[model samples]
Target: MKKRNQYSAEFKAKVVLEVLREEATVNEIASKYGIHPVMVNRWKQEFVDRASEVFKKGPSEAEKALEKEQQHVAELERKVGQLTYEVDWLKKKSDEILNRKRP
Candidate 1:
């Protein structure tokens, strides 16, 4: 099976912008870019949809919330790792003390 081609955001934007320019047909653009017309159309639609956010005053509420959630998850992961190390160290120390007492 052949893997699908992946274009970078910048390249997608460039192609989408060309389509929006009305100078060339979508088929022409797709053929030039070596991509499918359907893919080109999809990129153009995404470009149009996201274009509004570019003019918005600030980050959207959802974006801010998502960033906050990611940070919180990272902090929790750090704490979990620290606690796991501490628990492992305590178990080892306790086993050492128990062995000493047996002798």
Candidate 2:
């Protein structure tokens, strides 16, 4: 089977921009660019949707803080498991010692 052609991000962006400019229809743009019309339309819509947020800043500080809190919680859960195991081991040892002395 022959491998399909892969279009780069730059090429997709260019084609989407062209479609947005109204210089050509989606079908015409796809045929001229050797890409599928459906793919071209999808990219065009994505570009239009994200155009407003393109200039916006990255994730907010609250998002970053939540990520940090998640990491801390994972670490604490791991430590709790280790401590639980150690406590179980110590309890078994104490029970064995007490049973030996009960005679």
Local distance difference test, each candidate:
0.93, 0.89
lDDT of 2 by residue, 37-61 (tens): 9988888888888787667798766
Give me the runs in candidate 1 sitting further than 4 Å from their true place. Answer: 81-103
Q: Write the per-residue lDDT of candidate 1 for residues 4-69, one digit (tens) a residue.
A: 887898999899889999899999999998999999998888888888888899879799999999
lDDT of 2: 0.89
Model 1, residue 63: C-alpha shift (Å) = 3.6
Give the clashing residue pairs of candidate 2, or none: none
Alpha-carbon RMSD to native, per candidate:
3.1, 5.6
Worst 10 residues of 2 by lDDT: 52-61
How close is every model to the real structure, measured as TM-score?
0.68, 0.52
- Residue 74 in model 2: lDDT: 100
Model 2: residue 5 alpha-carbon error in angstroms: 3.0
